[model samples]
Target chain A: MHTSKVLVHNRDRSEIESEENYLPLNVLRLSKRFGGIHALNEVTFNIEEKSIISLIGPNGAGKTTFINVVTGTYPPEAGMIYFQGQNITGLPAHKIASLGIGRTFQLQELFLSLTVLENAMVGCHTRGRAGMFAAGLRIHPAKADEKRLREEAMENLKMIGLEQRASDSISSLPLGERKLVGMARALGMRPKLLMLDEPVAGLAAHEIENLVRLIHSLIDRGLTLFIVEHNMPFVMSISERVIVLDEGFKIAEGPPDDVRANEKVIKAYLGE
Target chain B: MKNSEIDRTHIPFIIMIAVIILLPIIIPSAYIISVMVFVAVYGVLALGMGILIGHAGLFSLAHPVWFGLGAYISGILAARGWVSPGIGIIVSAFFVALISYIIGAPILRLRGYYLACATFALLLIAQIAGGQLTNITGGHEGLLGIPPLSLGGFVFQTDLHYYFLSWALCIGCFWFCSNLIHSRVGRAIRSFHDSEIASKSMGVNIPKYKLQLFILTSVMASLAGSIFCFYLCFTVPSFFGFHLLVELLMMIVIGGIGSIQGPLIGSFVILWLRELIHIYFGKIFPVMTGEVDSIFFGILIIIVLIFMPRGLAGWVEQSFNLGRRTYAYFKGPGA
Candidate 1:
């Protein structure tokens, strides 16, 4: 229903007003090249605030490369990324993250040696202000800060129903649970936009359902989600808008039903 | 559960403190006391290396260079009566900290074996500088007659006095390190170690944390070297050589790489084993001489690696958990 309100690219006052009211992320003329191969070629898009969107492409369609460039894992050869209407292209990964962008890896990158609680607490690194000296001396304010950090981490774990397993080592958790932990950790950053790379890739049907429900709850809380996933049914069911990519080209972009009906998307998935 | 975890972690630290206090009273032999003093000195150095290698996962072979620099700086200052031994320690620590930051800024950017090779090159360069800078270092003949550490009226002259002083300093360093490892920065260091990508995504500045830990480790190593110089009332280039570096590395590996108690326990184990091997092997073999100790140490380390890959602290922790589980099993679920 919210996708119906998305403005088409135009200079009209009504379109400008709609863009200003909802747009949180805008990537323009993003391009990345590896030697002779163009991994991403002049791709451009904008994400509305608090909207759940899915990016779907066949293997090697530059989906991962696009995410990497946007998140500052790899700098785009040419492009500008604007978050909340400010230029943020080519910043370092940590700086980008501190600017309210959080991401999870395709293969879960949980701190395996640390406990679930600690892994989530690490996500709260940007929020805490206590320095090494303050922490080492056990300064009263630092202690209180640490207490608050723990509570916040716990609250994040609870969001994904993982607070009960907070003290368990990450290595002890199952794959599905580990993915949830990764999501919880990202949530701990309190990011305005959460980017998930293949969040439901290895989950069972029931687990996928649970994750979809959790994601819906997160969207309801005014958090925007940019999901890159291969599961078309799940993506179509949950994402208000779906963007299709084919070999680094933006082939289709619209509401899920409209994009599903596009011949280019069908050809991209079924092959030429 | 939180209270119980804190109590469990503190047990080893409390036991270590009790052992340090009881050792001099129980032994009282000057030879044994001096040997224990060496353990405390080396333990401090190993703890520094442990923080670098264990927490940050950086392999720095140039630790002895900082250690040597600390000793030579303190030795030169004390010999000239420019500053007291207390001031010497603080001055040398800051000096090393500054140098390490400058060096680490570039070096910490590198990863794995490249970083190791770069640091190793630094060690060789420092050793050469020690010999070539004859006016300052005294070259191969070594700096001598550095005055005993004293505070106004009291002089730390005897082995017993130095023993308590070194252990006290060692304990203080341990307390600082333990506190640091539990702090927010420490968590960031460990997270970076486990997953650099994840840590960076969580807004942890990887290079900044690595360089900070590197500087901290260097400062601690320098302080230990200063105390070691005062303990012997002299300094030597040979004291801060490749052999000592290897010994410091062995202490961390043998004690348990990441645990707080690992370096301290490792220093005691390696030093005691070396002494025992030297004393007994000389009498038993008669012909093998000093070579037997190295051969035995090699074999012992190999055996330790094969049996306990995580090191002694890990083994101790595993057994501690096993004990707790068995006790709970006998007590039943509700009890």
Candidate 2:
């Protein structure tokens, strides 16, 4: 299997060019099982570097499970995951995050008790080096690092157009605004590869359009995006490439127009 | 984005500090001074616990073990003339911190009730060790003749001096704690309390932060214990036991769980309530019987938990806002 991949790479050198530049995330035969159910079965795909890719499928089609596996929330039963040419399979969530993979939750897990700014500031955890003792002493270096983090967090909020709400409590925000805050927080991590789980699931039409535009801006800044969405129109319009899953199997993968017209994708969604 | 340099929430804290400073002058009674000293000692202990329970969202029953270790180590060293009380306090705190880190590394892996049970087991182990290690601890008979803390030539011989010392220590810990919570590290710790998974995804090392908080609180508790030993000039296993743990826990919960002022205010309220109950009910109810005081304490806790779920700090903040509104109304809108 490995030799076949190598042979294909060599043959397609003219078209694909460098492997590292072409693929930021590559999964080989990734499988996950829960008891008797196969949540993901030998799924294989590679996400292009600096491109916005979408994973869309019906509920229970293992869309979220795939994201979970990629983000290191759940270890795959078999196969390897490579991010930026490094095997990151089974690494803990925080370790994966530090390696430049950031994600937002589908249910919007904003730090509700904290201000929006503080919520984003938490994403600066990996970047800041000051520990509890240094913070307690209010040392010169720690203070400087904190000021930098605050400024950076504010910048992220501004990018998300939530700078005005930086000091507002997260609990006071509407669901759509809170979702943006989650994205802003993830962006604060300085992730090269950002995975968004159901980014437009419960958003209003206007909010969905706003998120679509924001994602485009993010991609323009040289960040790779892996998005999971059930919103077909939003996914179709925003993504350059779309992958279709059906009951733990990838039924289709191509440009949005091709995937949308694929017989397998239509049958998988229509259940005939 | 109104950049008010100072947090308005600190107004109540300023008032509290002013009240504490004026307490000794207004009363000047030896008994009152001693009561205030007890409040300060427990305030320090509870503030440490607050960082764990309130900030880090961890509950440990083993704080008394660290507290007892502090008192016993200081007491033994002072009695044997091996070290000065001041050095003993610092040494004991480091020792307890080391033990807490070593034990906490593995035990903190268990979450919620399991973590609570593991720490409770540690408390029992410490109790057993205290009873068995008679050579140093003096066992149940207790270690006596522990010298009072002195600075160079001046010894803290009076309750007044000890009162000032304990409060000074409490205030210093409070300052350090407030600085910590407002800093970047404190924000990460608070993030853990809200959602561990979210915190982890944000690149916060969950286990490392938890263990750091556990060790820090343990060291703070140990320092309070050392001061407690010097203040009493003696130590016993019973001094650091389940009752003290319960009282300290009550202080943080009743004062406000996550707020800095919560533990301090909680400590003052609990101690004052216990004293008032002991004095007034001692004659009316059976003097030796524990039922009346226990019943009253239980009722008071129930009322506070039900009425002011966020504790006294939350209640005070609400009332402070109310007071502002009333003043604004009386001063005629524009004022």
Candidate 3:
């Protein structure tokens, strides 16, 4: 319901009102190229603050590249990314991450040998302030940061219903659980925007149900979630809006039902 | 096995302190005592490298250079007679930290084999500098008249004194390092080992953390080297040479690569192996050579990699069931 369009571009800085309400993320004509292939070309979309939006497309539709560019994983050939109305394009991945954007890998990139809680704690790196000296000495600030990180990580694991297994080795968890742990780890960053890449790519029906519930809970907690997934039913059921991409271009964008019924989206999925 | 890796680093350290206190009293044999002293010095060296290669999964062959530089800097500074050896060691550490920062900033950009090779080249260059810089290093004859470490006017006069000092320093380093590894920076450094992408997305500044750990490892090596300087009362180009790197690599592999205790345990194993070779294989060759240690180290490394990639320390950690029982026993029924 909070879905919006890109309403401002190349505007004079003096005229931009600080008091105006803004989307959490806004992108303008993002483009990426690998040699001759246009992995992403002139794609544009804006995510509303604290809304659940789904991005879906057929294989090789540049869904992953789009997310990678937006999250600063891949350098865009040309584009401007605005996070909370500040230009974030061309920033390094960690810099962008520290600016309140968190993402999970398509293949869950959980630290395999560490405990689940530790994995989440590592995600809270940007939030902590103790340097090597402070950490090594375990001084007041360092101790407090570490203690706070543990609590934050534990809180995230609890939020994801994984506090019981917090001490369990990450590798011991099943794939679905590992993905959730990855989400919990990303949550440790306490990002304004949390992006999930193919969050339910390989989940059972019950796992999907659990993930849907988790997503809804995250939304209820006043967090924006940008999910790149292929599960049409899951997307339609959970997403307030869906943006359809094909061949590195946005084909349709609207409420999930409208996007689902759009002829362009149908053609993109089933072909002409 | 469940969580021993995190908890067990301290157990060996405490046991090592007890051993450090008891060993000099029990063994009293000068030659064996000196070897144990070598274990302490090299143990610190290995701990430094362990953080780099073991926990952070960095490959570096340049640690010996840092150690050598620490020795020379501390030796040169302490040799002046005005500054205390303790001050000399501290100054040497800062120098090594600065130098490592300057060098690491560029070298860490090269990943895997390239990084290893860059560090290897650095080792060779530093070795050459040690030999050629005669005015400063005193060349092959070694810098002479370097005083023993003195604190509050009590001078250490013998190997026994150094054994206590070196092991004490080793214990101190271990304590701080253990604290470090349990802290947030430690987790950040370890995160780089498995998932750079995940760590990056977590807002971990990978390059910064890498360089920070690099400098810390170098500083630890500098500390060890400084102690080595004070203990020897002289400096040599050969003390921190290429062979020392090979020896350190063997210690890391044999002891266990990642954990803090790995290097200390590996240092003990290698030293014991040296003593064994001296007892048994010394008769086979009229003149002992570095080649001898190489053959033994190469074979041991292969055996370690194949049988237990984690090394002896890892093995100890795996069978820490005995340790847990002992710990539980000491703590009482409820604890």
Which candidate achieves the best TM-score against the true structure? 1
The DockQ scores of all candidates, in the order shown, are 0.65, 0.75, 0.78
Residue ranges of candidate 1 with Cα displaced over 4 Å = A1-22, B1-11, B286-289
Off by over 4 Å in 3: A1-9, A12-19, B1-12, B80-82, B322-335
How do all the candidates rank in terms of TM-score, highest first? 1, 2, 3
> What digit string (tens of lDDT, one per residue) describes model 3 on residues A24-47?
887777889888888787777788
How high is the lDDT of residue A46 in model 2? 87
Residue pairs in steric clash, candidate 2? none
Using DockQ, give the best candidate's number. Answer: 3
Model 1 vs. true fold: TM: 0.94
Tens-place lDDT per residue, model 3, B1-335, is: 83786468568667877887888788788888888888989998998888789889889889999999899898898887757887888888999999999999999988889999999999888888888888988888898989888878889888898888888878888887878888988888888788888888888889998998899889888988988888888888888888799888889988988787788889889988988887777778748745686688788899999987999988877779678989999999998
In the range B1-335, model 1's lDDT, one tens digit per residue, is 98997698577568878988898789878999999999998998899888888887898888998888888888888888899877888888899999999999999898989999999999988988888888887888888779988777588889989888888878878877887788777888889888898899889989888988888878877877887888887776777888998888888888988887899889999999888887888798888756887787788778779988778988899999999999999999998
DockQ ranking of the models: 3, 2, 1
Minimum summed lDDT over a 10-residue window in model 3 chain A is located at: A1-10
The deviation in Å at residue A19 for candidate 1 is: 7.6
* Shift of residue B256 alpha carbon in model 1, Å: 1.4
